[model samples]
Target: MVQKETFGEVIRKLREESGLPLRKVAAHLDIDPSTLGKIERNERTANKEMIEKFAEIFSTNSKTLLVSYLSDKVAYEIMDEDCTKDILKVAEEKIKYYKKVKKLIVMPTKTKIKPYKEIDSDVLTLAEEEAYQLRIGENPDDIDLDVIDKINVWDKSVKVEENGYYWKGEPYITKGKLPANDKPLVVELFCGCGGTSLGFELAGFEIAIGCDIHQPSINTFKTNHPNVSTVLGDVRKVNPKSFLQLLDGRQVDVLIGGVPCQGFSLNNRKRHENE
Candidate 1:
């Protein structure tokens, strides 16, 4: 089973279930049979190329294997540490911040996104005191923390199974009685957990509906935007007339969303520069 299985265990299960022996996949990975066996037995790690090769040989989604491997790596790093969850929370924020900056900004300016842990205190102090006077007017507070709306495009967002708390964004804690402003009717496609939509709502927009192909995401979205309509399936097959009917004669303000970018998503696929 994929659930709760270590990376090694998952790979082993996949191979065994498919009735493929150890040497078959190992040959595909171009590694020795013993090494691949070690990988299956959790005695060794698999490289990115090996992970990619596994997907090819097994005819499986590369993302599934990649996700398992990355998560396993994280687990190993934090296995014996106290407050591992706390470390993960901070790491999540950092991942979002770094990814956001890399994808949308910094590329054109030749700006390098360095981790705060690497920066000297003196440099940070100077940045706090004098960065604003040089060009853009902003203090430590402005730069240290970010706008909620901007940060909402995180790699990970709120995930709740049932009657759970809203871990982030508006409708926080519970989807209590929401007073709406007469703003534009917002509908998001592939909206996961309603993070960005919630930002829009907080900025006074009325969220009308959210649709995604993921069941868990729809579950989360329904929890947050309790009043909003949600569709869960291939939106391509959905009848436009029926989709509009959900709007109930109200005009939509804007439609926005992008499909998953393989390398920079929750799966967070990593590869060698040469690969």
Candidate 2:
């Protein structure tokens, strides 16, 4: 069986193999060196898109890179011992199912574990557990109920307390006109739910192509942007040449994206230190 590695270990391994200094890699990717440094240290999780970028820069596969991390190993082992193996196994299966079905799949819960009569009665899932754990909160780690329900509970509780929502229901819009003869064009990366793409449309840009790793989000995007082409895979795995090919003879005016945000959270405080 392939052993799992941590985020830090993989970053260090890739850096060493690339024969490039940290600054050089960061400069090439337009990332701050200190941010890259902390990712190597496993203090934070890189978002899906960024992990793909790292894989591309280092000439490695994301799955191969992810499984080599020690932290992932530790986390898996802990989950297994805590009887959450079934949840992870199921989640992996669901992801596979989505790929095979070529449709959007949503896993809102893990194994169905009912709450005690003396406690709350709700169900949850493994993905939900991880989401709850990753959030900023003051809850003790408890896996009695389903992880998904716990996350919902957390979300609802937070919403009630803050009287806030994560995103505005309304979208931004702009108006413009392109030449009738101008070729329709779009370049999208980390294209989650096509929010950025919508923004481009508001500005009168026609989307020709888009890419993202999340099958569900991509499926939703495809439904909303039926005329646009989409690639259901990591952007890093996409060959730059292939990306160029999608545009054919047309020139792209705007590149839209929501590249990994988690990586920046690690060293955002130190961003101005060297300045």
Candidate 3:
């Protein structure tokens, strides 16, 4: 059987096929030839920008190239772990679900009306009171009235399912009305299980999107907030523009992230302050 080629191997093969020397390509990318060589040998990792530069040089799809590079990095990082295969399986499932949800949200349909008596009156009343307060001083056009409309939709009790996930309980609506002129929008990076997103939502912020590499964590997040868009992939592999695309022209009020901190955690087996 032929061995699988790594991202490094693919890059090296392309460079050799194009008859470009390491020094020449490195000069064009403004990186040292030694650094480029290490990257090709898998001794060093390339950032997203560097990978994009490589894609340009090789005339390849930047997203595909970045995914390959990130896959290699993830593999290397978890090589010594016993649950690597399980983790990857979960990641794949989560990514698949994320794509499905993204498609559904991008093209939503009108939800059918149901009897108001069957709905949760407490939540509906709260939503109505909040909406009234917000509209008291602001023009209707200035506010995202769609948010209130969403609350009204939730006034009907119905089971909803999307992309294999099901919900029949109270709708996961924001606790209060967002500001008429400035609804705070957040983009969360490394958003594990969406704890921060939940907090922000409770504080009346719109969670524009969230991203995480781990599959199980993202699955939990999706289960809780099915309406929020999420990306299941390595943050290093994702382009900044991709996050903007999720916003769909909405301005981001906050950008939050909780990067890997296992090495610094007190419970870590190999804890190090300098890490």
Candidate 4:
């Protein structure tokens, strides 16, 4: 069996075949002579630029050099490892999955969300409609349309979080309007005196519930949102069961809140209500 040559070996062979001295090639490649020698011995790795330069110096195919380099890397990486065949088998599947998948950009947490436009398209499927529910936060339309098409077709593969909407493991695909509602339901956290909830209610959304840490603020919230449920507790400790019971089978059409300023935290040396 003929041994497959490593990238360095192939390049070194080409250099020797051309009768080019090592230092002369190193001068052309802009690397030290020792580095070039190590590369020839395959004790150093070759970068893409160096591979292309090697091809230029030796009049060889750039692709052939690159292929040898990549193959050597893969072989060395998997060599002397347990279950090498299993590693390649799983890697092959992952490579296929990656090739078939588009890289999606995830929006940062705390990204400001724009309310979706009014729903209008007749071609919208139920799956697409449910995907629209995420618009209460981010719309998937903000991402690649081709990627969104795949996501919608693939059962919407998403996880809704307090931080943001995730597609598979990626975050914040925005598009499509919020679900149709005459008065979209609203729930508030860190609801100091229900100011934001009051604004949504005035804008035609129904204030469903509000939670605040201060008894005074909760009382004020009740005064402002007479028909809405009120929870007086740190939002972090609010009972999930009671919270859901307050929803009473109705989905939250909106979640609005304004928490204490960072200045209010004990960590802030000058923290005070004035902040």
Residue 206 of candidate 2: its Cα lDDT?
84
State the lDDT of candidate 3 residue by residue for 1-275, as single tens digits.
Answer: 43367887878988999899999889878999998898789787777788878888888888878778787878888889999989999989988865654443322124632222222345435644444344343333565657855652222254333323322232222222223346699888878899999899899888878777666777887887777777777666666777666676678999999887855564443333443
What is the lDDT of every predicted structure here?
0.68, 0.60, 0.69, 0.69
Deviation from native of the Cα of residue 61 in model 1, angstroms: 1.2
Residue 184 displacement (Å), model 3: 55
TM-score to native of every candidate shown: 0.39, 0.32, 0.35, 0.38
Ranking by TM-score: 1, 4, 3, 2
Tell me how candidate 3 scores on lDDT. Answer: 0.69
Residue 140, candidate 2: how far off, in angstroms?
42
Please identify model 1 stretches exceeding 4 Å from their true place.
Answer: 104-275
Q: Tell me how far the alpha carbon of residue 152 in candidate 1 is from the true structure, in angstroms, after superposition.
A: 53
Please report the candidate that would top TM-score against the real structure.
1
Please provide, for model 1 over 1-275, each residue's C-alpha lDDT reduced to its tens digit, 9 standing for 90 to 100: 54588889989988998899988878778789899889889999888767777887788999999899999999999989999999999999988865653443222123533322222445334533343234323233445444643543333344323223222322211122323555788878878889989998898888877777666787888888888887776666566776566776778888877554543553332321121
Return the lDDT, model 2, position 22: 92
TM-score: model 1 vs. ground truth = 0.39
Cα TM-score of candidate 3: 0.35
Mark the 10 consecutive residues where model 3 has the least summed lDDT: 169-178
lDDT of 4 at 166: 12
What value of lDDT does candidate 2 attain over all alpha carbons?
A: 0.60
Q: Give the Å shift of residue 59 in candidate 2.
A: 2.3
* Runs in model 2 lying further than 4 Å from the true structure: 66-81, 93-275
Candidate 4 RMSD to the correct structure: 23.8
